[model samples]
Target: MADDTGNLELEAFRAEARAWLEANFPPALKGKGGLAMAEITFQDADLATWRRAIGEKGWATPTWPKEYGGGGLSRAQARVLQQEMGRIGAFNPLMFGMGVTMIGPTILDYGTEAQKQQHIPPIVRGEVQWCVGYSEPNAGSDLASLQMRCEDAGDHWQINGSKIWTSGAQYSDWCGALVRTDPTAKKHDGISFILIDMHQPAIETRPIKLIAGASPFCETFFTDATAPKDAILGELNRGWTVGKRLLQHERASQTGDRGPGGGGSAVALADLAKRYAGADAAGRIADPDLRTRVIRQQMDAKVHGLTLARAAAEAKEGASNAASVLKNSATHVAQTRAELMLEIMGHQGLGWDGEDFTREELEAVRGWLSGKAMSIYGGSFEIQNNIISKRILGLPDSTGST
Candidate 1:
């Protein structure tokens, strides 16, 4: 059966994927139940099975070249793969961290043949977890002013300073980070984008507990952490270009506009409305005024999804900067949906803790809080506005800075 599935042509791949998923993926991991279930943890066997299947088909990183351990599938085939995965309600096995999200794409764009050969396969296979080390205590919004230094030592660079808000750093095996390679140069001029081994003695990570009690972000410190001279991702003193490209990919991923089962938010929202307010609840969803708002939000979510698809198509057609607008717009729409979901719940939404809080309420609160950071993290809302104003709109550069 596996061999037959493997031999499937483009048309047959979707059918095979659907059949395989039906047979292999548990019902609990399928459809609305799979997403609504509060637990974020995945069983090792389940993860392994899904990863092996996606990895074999290169559906994990579908558009990447075959030589660098990708599925070498056409964009059309990749879309089919996504549709099949969505039909089965199979969650993305690579959605956990930066390995698949940021680093993998960055390496594909800027990495040498050697680097691509070394890095891409493991990441696609889920053998490695990577994290971003872009933010520092004082250097988040104004990222170029970062003070983390990397000193040349003939064959290696000794790194020092701290990175704050390093997501999943404690569990990450590698970090694609920015460090100051030349202190005398201007803020952004001398920065170097380098890959750092997270298991080294000089690295220390302390998780920062959030208001929700779980800490997904960490403070990472480096004390003379050594990286091989070849760890540089792009040109030595021209890392700003590489960093910007990586940021573009990160922003695109955060838009939640790609991959299989991507429309979970809309489905979740519909489920919440029906379960909480009922099918014909007055002034809830059936009420004319409230119904208008609900319908508008649903339309907006659909528009956002379609816009993302257009942007992806544009990217594949050589419009590289299309992601910027799609990302900014998608984040705004998602935040709006989160707000509406809470509004639909009304009184029940107010509760943050305790068993009295329904799963919907808990999710709403966490999502609302997290949505606040969506505008800030992958370049702030302000930053995106500036990009649109200057680059897309051809506005005058009043600030004289990027």
Candidate 2:
């Protein structure tokens, strides 16, 4: 799949990629498999092998610059690689998290050449994991109001604050966090984006349990957690701008638009429907009204996916604001799919946990509950609507009902 002479057609690249993945990626790893297949775990050795293969080829981050240990492929070629990988049912080598979704993009766009050279390669090779430290207990939607203080010293900064809803922090090696660097300035003015070493003795993470019984998120406490002077991501006291851009990338990834491979809720939903609602179950499609709704949702998902592709293509050509629309559409699609899945399962979807419940039933309930956050996180639905109106439609801000 290497574009050696810079003239290889996408079709040829895809053919080569498909053959390579088929030959290498285990068949069991492909597609949405059954319960047993889903239960199959990839250990450290397995993950290392996959990461090394993809990292060596720079295929893990194909569109990234070659100097940063990326494939240096064009967007078109990257799409070909994704399609071929999907064709062979190859799971993405890099695990999804704040690292790939948020921090990596921020570093790429705003970091100095030296910072990029140091950070991007390790991330591309899965050598480290990262988390975002944005949402404090009091400052989620109003992120500018964060109170995490990073006091300046001679060589480093002393960070002290609590960050809530930090996903994967317990497992992360580092965090791309927002801290108040200048208390004298306005809420948005004093903040700086800094990379915190999670392994520090002063840093602590306590898992926060959710309604779904999973605690992937954490409450992180930084008590004089020190970050080197070089750890600052962008201009000092101008981190909000960099942070917002990173959030944009984070939102895009959550919506399944940005990142190494495109995101989709359809495959997961369809699999659930097939398993819980059965191939031709009455609840699945017998009701014309429900069937119409499902078809509409499926069409909408496809449209959203295509819209994301279009936006990404435009971005590659230097367009701005395409991400806003794509993010809005993708989040809505995901929320709808979650609701539809629950509806399709009906009474069976109500179970929380028990041996009596099948895996499909458990998934339906957990997914339905978790899906509620889709619109809220990554900028709330109201915020997205505001962006669309002001930025896309050129409408004035209004409190009045449409």
Candidate 3:
């Protein structure tokens, strides 16, 4: 009886969601969710309007609390909202921001009431862009070895040093960073997480263009930058813990926690193969080997989706170690698809730009090129393997420490 009642209530919510989305989601933006970028999120009038609409409705973060300007929907209802949004090809305009994916959730996890009041509302409203400061030139995977320094000032905190591969720093209004707060302590123990304003003169960002063309990554230097004393997240010298927690959030978002249909309008593998490689008499891919490989790729994708769904259902209010496992899996599925796509497109996939190829084909070439970084970013494949073995499987670290 309870289950039946819940189902009835969810059905009512679904109907309500359908109506509300139909009225509020702009027709011009339908099926165009993949087109919005944080740098230009507000550049187009229609896209800005769509962002404001969804942010205000708080459906951009459906399962978050209402107090923080979130929709306050239950997990079940959030799923329903996603289903309705997917029904019309509507995407979360704000999901592209690292604020929503990594920093905001970490704030909610470890922030004080005052900090939450200061930050989460702006995030939920899509009012600011955020970047992360973790990787240093010397400390890519050994992030704990990062030397970016933070110190106590009489009235404020002083920040110095730099971050490399700081994604979206040029456009970000703020940064959530891991810094060395206690230099005398162990590398992992001396870290502190803090929030910094990007607008100050002490900070400068230089963009790093990748082979894929325009990129969001930058080398961000902080020369005696400043933050309020309260800007430190969690306890002083306890940021390694906080930073790991944030990584879990990062991995989860990378694994598609951005809600249903949040992956954008990416063409399916089978469809792409059928279109590019031609088809057999029975409608399989024309090439027998390609057909089998495509089927396997599709199956792998399906397994990742199912695993992700199950994990999401079982996950609690913050992230967990399981995210590490799923992140690698997601990377595998995505990279495999990109490889298959390029092979199926043959020389046609080699298009850089010209009238000879379609926009999707051009993007496919770039995607295939950029896809190589998947195993490197968001923690490397080896890093994730270490995490899985040590944390999940209770294996020992290289130092013979558990």
Highest-scoring model, lDDT: 3
Candidate 1's C-alpha runs over 4 A off are 1-10, 32-45, 263-268, 281-284, 316-319, 353-360, 400-402
CA displacement after TM-score superposition, residue 236 of candidate 1 (Å): 1.1
Model 1 lDDT per residue over 51-97, tens place: 67666666677777888778787777777878877766766666545
Model 3 Cα lDDT, one tens digit per residue, 284-307: 778889889988988988899899
Better of 2 and 3 by lDDT: 3
| Candidate with maximal TM-score | 3
Model 2: weakest 10-residue lDDT segment is 32-41
Cα lDDT listed for each candidate? 0.77, 0.75, 0.87
When summed lDDT is taken over every stretch of 10 residues in candidate 1, the lowest stretch is 32-41
lDDT of 2 at 233: 92
Total clashes in model 2, counting residue pairs 3 or more apart in sequence or in different chains: 0
In model 3, what is the error at residue 135, expressed in angstroms?
1.0
Query: Residue by residue across 305-336, what tens digits does model 2's lDDT show?
Result: 88777766556532266666777787778778
Q: What is the TM-score of each candidate against the true structure?
A: 0.88, 0.87, 0.95
Give per-candidate clash totals.
0, 0, 0
